[model samples]
Target: MPQERPVEDLTEADAKAELDRLAKAIAAADQAYHQNDAPDITDAEYDALKRRNRAIESRFPELKRDDSPSDSVGAAPADGFGKIRHEIRMLSLGNAFDDSDVTDFDARIRRYLGLPGDAPLTYTAEPKIDGLSLSLRYEAGVLVYAATRGDGETGEDVTANARTIAQIPQKLTGAPAVLEVRGEVYMTHAAFADLNANGPRTFANPRNAAAGSLRQLDAEITRARPLSFFAYAWGVVSEPLAATQFEALERLASFGFSVNPLTRLCLSPADLLTHYRRIEGDRPDLGYDIDGVVYKVNDLALQARLGFRATTPRWAIAHKFPAETAWTRLEAIDIQVGRTGALSPVARLAPVNVGGVLVSNATLHNEDYIAGRDSQGEPIRGGRDIRVGDWVQVYRAGDVIPKIADVDLTRRPADSTPYVFETTCPQCGSAAVREPGDSTHRCTGGLICPAQAVEKLKHFVSRNAFDIDGLGAKQIEMFFADDVLSIREPADIFTLARRDSSNLGKLKNRDGFGERSATKLFAAIEERRTIPLARLLFGLGIRHLGEVAAADLARHFGSWDALISTVDRASPAAERAVAADSAELVERARAADEGRRAELKKTRDAIWDDPPLPDGARTAWDDLIGIEGVGSVLAVSLVTTLSQPGERRSINRLIAELTEIQPPEARATQSPVAGKTVVFTGTLTRMTRAEAKARAEALGAKVAGSVSAKTDILVAGEAAGSKATKAEALGITVMDEDAWLALIGG
Candidate 1:
């Protein structure tokens, strides 16, 4: 219920209250589902609650309580079965909803592995059974134990029940000396129907029938109900069964264990999708229920290279079938402001079941989307707008955010009025305006708006920013609201301890803080006084200046004073260049002849080449934009943030209060490419461009995108173009990918 409060309106007190409520609610649900085996809430409802908890925790990480549900897996083992602790944690696979998601999964894998786009990679695609996960242990080619996947770490031993299953092998002739075969314990639709009809009790679905039957306290009861096992994976093994995942599955089948017949090898995303479609087409006749298709990196060596994340293996993902849809009433539309001052609309809906999940809320991207206009300004839904009290179709496919798919005009309320978007900040009554070419409207109040202020402060101390040990989002909001730590800007954070020391009200006596915690917090703040220039720049929360860009700027300038002075001097020149570019664009648009338009376009491109400014100012402007990744957009963002009188004064004050930031350490001279400016171009065959750049930088080389007189080496790959030619013309060293690799001893 506390989550019903808009995220923007949630104060520190509200967040704490909501987190406590969610923790208790989720813990109870987990107990009922995992222990009692009789869930009070639907799976979708449970997922929604967990999703809400995660969202809130992300926004207020410092407020994550000792009993935070994010850290938990499943419920504790039930009382009946003996508890077996797993040697290797049985993690879950992340889900993908559609084709784009599956593609993204592949791209992410390639990125993590540093594989080139055209590199040969293979995957094993198999049907993801909708059943309870079971793990069977074998030692010396003989069955040792069997257990359920309970909370990923510990499970309830069901060796007696598992022994009765025909698909499970009691002894293996050719298998690893020590192996733990992990798979699903499922029941076919025919078996489920027959058992439910013959037995006194009925079942909801095949998955529930399988889980309930397998988890029975009496082994005889479990055996009486038809249960089957399919070995798809393994936990602990003395040695790998095969070089590839597909081969391993085949090997499992050869060892007298049942394996899913639909499993196959996929060389690309296209192949994976083809297999998924084939499975989906045959799903109705497969006798067993399958929710999706699971894809894993085929090569065991590649799988090892791509390790695991916190909860899921990086080498695997599940592409789920589209979720079932249901109609619900649109109760209300609420505008929520984000940390960046962008206003987003959320639709509150009457609860409806969608793919076994209870759906109540969905995102309405922006005003245009709500008004039936696409991002390209094209009409959608026949230009019909969604109004409150209208019947709307809601969808929830895999991990994708729930959304309103369609509206039913037949069920529209007669009295419903067209929704009006707000033009003023809902929290601070400031003017909200949309800029040219932007889809969403933003509040102009900046630091004055409570929503923006709280968000900015949160970013200032984020993990990549100041990263103050004790000051978190929740604490920041609490202190800001109580006026005990009035951090209107980043500078105020540094001055907090000094200001609090002189005030009658102190942090040590606060409700959540004691003398020790308060003191530790101050110490944490004090320790950050002598910070790195990159972190300090990033902590300012300047738009478009991310961690990488901040580091690039810091490396380019070498010191805080140098960066500040250069940017300050370059501000005017950059603004003039931007103005000139805009004017030339306007002239091009108004030009009557093609020749004149072409000339205008050429002039626009030349504006940055020779900007109208003093000699020193022009040089500063050129250097600011000449960094490897820094471009016109980022350069303008830096100049704009630094040019604002109020923001600049605040930054200057913050700088005065702290020690000067230290430049990054010089690269070691021992490195092969130390202090060299290296440029990479064209299609790299062995590795990705990102990987090449990372390798070069690790070897103490500065990797630039373009070749210039300063470039020491140009590593050209196949199809090398202008950069390679330019490098040769400049008399700089040019080497092919293989030659470059040999030079680095790759």
Candidate 2:
């Protein structure tokens, strides 16, 4: 197998090859979806592939193919139905998969219109119906023709089938002389289930059933299928409909068309986000399926100004909700040990398709999760425990990682039993202990366990870490297990060229590495001699440590020596806190008397207040904890893990190999919030949480996850709760959204 190349490093030739491959793959998927009404891939996966193609074309426009997926909409009209050429192209929207993407969409529109930052731009937020797109052309208040949105310019004539849907009126009472109502043709969840129960064939989903029923050769079959429609847009209109989208929707509703009642006029991105949340919460009870939410410029004039892109509209964006759930058999359960000695349970699933992606494995979270309980011992998934030979619902978390969402108790085999979680580490026989207030079980063997060592080494060379080219996960495993000239530690990678120059055989003769590849690997290693401070910190693979937290630490301390000293000084204090908390728990569990439990709490408080440590140990602990994102959990992870003898020696060896540790860049901002840790709580009315975080980061503020002794400021919104109280007790500055805006001079 060949090593995968990063898109950023791809040559023009490589780009062209990838584009060719994507075009073919996308064309096949489009046909399966639009033509056959049977999608092979999830909408998320398909969108990702298209996004990749578009990104490549943007970078290498000259190499773009005429048949590029970026220039197309749906597949050409299916065969059987007579094709109707659309008078005006049916618009397909660009997608925003997350909050940041939505924020960027808003910013892009403002920039295109040359509007000021404070300008209020409104949008119409509605559900993106997961159904077939249909165009109904009405001439002089009577329905003349109807077509499906096939390949944008043409469609399948569904005129006879269209007349059956009561929502799609045969004649509009107050409609334009020449109006083409563009909307969705769908089947409700109830209707779809009824069809599958009574009809000859079972459909894949509501969307597919709706499409297949509407496209039937006989209009009687379509009429019998319980079809429905929701008019949301117009394709070709003879006269003006309305000046704004909200008013236009109202006009359509007046013309005897069924419009979505959930649609709302949003004055800002925050309003749209709020509406999106509401709709997502209402999705399960909606009695119909909707994949995501769509936001369009409310003003028709401004929408025209924004115009259209090559394939999608610049003014409209689909904020897609990922991870469609699917059910499959729970084949087996396995446990995988991580670099930090954390033992994570993994579910081996009978292969199933979820959101167009094939899944065979999913994250089980922990033993408690499998036992139908959360970290707080609260029941989940209706208190149904997961067992082998049971049917499980798998969710594609963030549209990438698969996770077990629920289990079907009714489908469990009669002989099946609850899974027994391992009390000892599987790799090496050592006690795996689940700590107080912690969810995961951890191996006590440390690096003595082969799983921990190898996982750590792999993490060291991961893309976000050293990122050594040609040295991937498989190569790492091979080298770790090699009898001759094995690479066991991170330092061994830097010393390979030197070791090869000795009596050892050359790497060029190896099975996977030729002279060119070996030379390239060595060059890649050499290029990373001077490591970035954040990458080095992240490469350590400490429990609860992340890239963002590492960057925050690096930016705060500026150098390795400073970080080491702070962690070292805080170690005794952190150890005392953990020990004190554990002791309190032990005593309280044994105590039946309320007085005894209260006494134990006071004893724990005494230890917390005065832990026998060096004079500045308490202050150092506070400093470490105060750095936003690095609360007690991460602080303890850093101090306790690195202080271990084996980890210390390993880190020392790797540090010796580094030429330099480049400090993380600090933004030269003069804003008052810059370098301060700010925590936002309650309902933020001025902006969405995502927008607040991005704005804070831009001004060099560290947005902490929770309130702590080190928090510098707390921006409290309406109905402020525990965080605000804690901030007040800590003497942290508190302000409302309006005060925050004023202080920031916005």
Candidate 3:
């Protein structure tokens, strides 16, 4: 037999040629999968091809084409719909298969922005529908045209058909001169069934059903199809509408378009996951089909900075849910340890298709998962038991990594036997221990554990922590593995700058970085040596001492030395005095009062009924309580966390390095419109009502929910509503949104 060609050995030229070939093939496949709804290959096979192409391209960047197969849109435009040019292009999103992909996306975004690792990047998430794309255009506050996303730049025109949709307004409540909104048009499972029963032809899927309705040459036929729209994008705009995606959607609804109300705003990835879970829970109950959830960085500025790849935007990614699952043979069980030394069981399976990826393994999670088996000794509870050569169901959820979903006892091989759980760590040979409350087993090797060391190092340089430049999680793992970095403690990170770069063989050969990168990393470490006291405090990884608390500590103490002293000096009585300007403090100190000084101290501490205090103590007490948003609980946490012997020692060293650095304490500024409250009514000429509200807040004006006699100004625009009449009755001035904008000089 002929020897099989190895992909790794392919030269740059060979790789480029192969990649280009695959790109064309994949693009064709994407068109078929998305546009035609008749896939040429299964999702798993398509994913494998794409994954392989990506790997090759990553290995040889020169092989990567600008319009590679990896850059295809997931959704296709419906036929028969007319095309409309967008004012600003509506783009698609990239996808992440695992944690690594997400981290890489974040790293690139931060790098592009020239922002420090700790610089905040917020994200918003929405569901990615498996439906047809449509563009709705409004001119002079009236519905004008609706089209399909034919080729992103141009789409088919379907204006008359779109007019029949009851949810879309013929004339908006209050529309802009020229407004073009892009969203997904889909058919609900129930609606699709109803349409088929009442109409000419039955549709195969919701995507097809939506496409059929949207593409009808006759407007009446298109309107007859039970179709719904969820605005996910915009085409052209004459004026700026919203600052964020969430805000934009709200504006769409206000303009008389029926937008999906389930859209949400998530502050963090954890919160993003919460929304995903909500979608998962409601998927079956939902009327339409959703492939997965789409997440975008919430800040418009950040989104612009992130920009887009050739086909997809960098700021957004789709988290796909799994649709189909299949059974595969379980070959063996292996244990993978995490940075926290938790032993995770992995099911080694015969290569099987799940979603679009080649599934070779699945996570068992823990001992209970492995031991929970049916009467036949196969894993139960919808998961497969770890048995050698047993057939197991591998399932993928919304493009998430595949997992073992169930076991097929009927297909189990005769030679297979019940699997035995490992007693020792695979990497360190340490005894694995499972705590009573925890589901995961742990390796007792501590710092010596390779998994633990790599994980700790990764965490140390993560965006939220030290945020060392040029040190990504993968690089940290490699450096730790090569003995270039250690994970014994936080201080070890600083020592890396002193490493002998000449002797670092691994650093010389790394893909993204070389000896020059090592030098830059050293410089970055040196740069962080004199970190702000708050950052330094937060870097220590003290439990519950978040960035906010650290800033509070820094502000209250002024300097590290002051903070250390206060912590050492802090006592229960001092804490009580800080919490409450107690009366008892006055009488006891009055004995030493001179020249009626007791009265002054009482006033200073707001302790008129309490005893007198020295000027210095009063000053400290006053300074402590004066800070905004700081109260008894937080103040106590700050004092106690900094007071521990270990914490104080660590902070003392940090203080020594932070001696010259000082951050100013924040103070509440006098509001520009503090004395007067404002009420808004009717439409605004210059801005949206929401924009007016934000402006009022910025100007330090309290925006009342309704008009009252106390309303200082009411900017009423064209077609003033009942609010304007009521304001007049209450003797409150009325103004439109535009007039209000002008009044605020916005």
TM-score of each predicted structure versus truth = 0.67, 0.55, 0.44
Query: On residues 569-621, what C-alpha lDDT tens digit does candidate 2 reach at each position?
Result: 88889898788878887888889887796789787888877746787787888
Give candidate 3 regions above 4 Å deviation. 1-18, 33-61, 74-87, 328-746
The sequence of per-residue lDDT tens digits that candidate 1 reaches over residues 142-169 is 9999988887789999998898898999
The local distance difference test score of each candidate is 0.78, 0.79, 0.61
Residue-level lDDT tens digits of model 3 in 1-746: 00101244344323433443454456666677656656666554555456556666556542334345555444346554445665555555555555456566666666555555777667767777877777788788777778666545566677887777776677876656788888888888988888778877766677777876777778778766767877777767777678877787788888777777777887656667778879978988887888678778777765654555455676787765545788888888777766556666677888976655577877565566666643344555655455777777876542223556667778878777666677788889999886654454678997678766665555445444456787766666566655444534455556555545554455456667788886787778777776666656545544334444455556545576676554445444355465344444454466465666656555545532255444344344334433322444444555665666765675454444432454533332375454355766654545445545545655656555455454677667777788688878888766555455555554
Task: Rank all candidate structures by their TM-score, best first, as comma-separated numbers.
Answer: 1, 2, 3
Worst 10 residues of 2 by lDDT: 1-10
Best by TM-score: 1
Model 1 RMSD in angstroms: 8.6
**How many residue pairs clash per model?**
1, 3, 36
Which window of ten consecutive residues has the lowest lDDT sum in model 3? 1-10
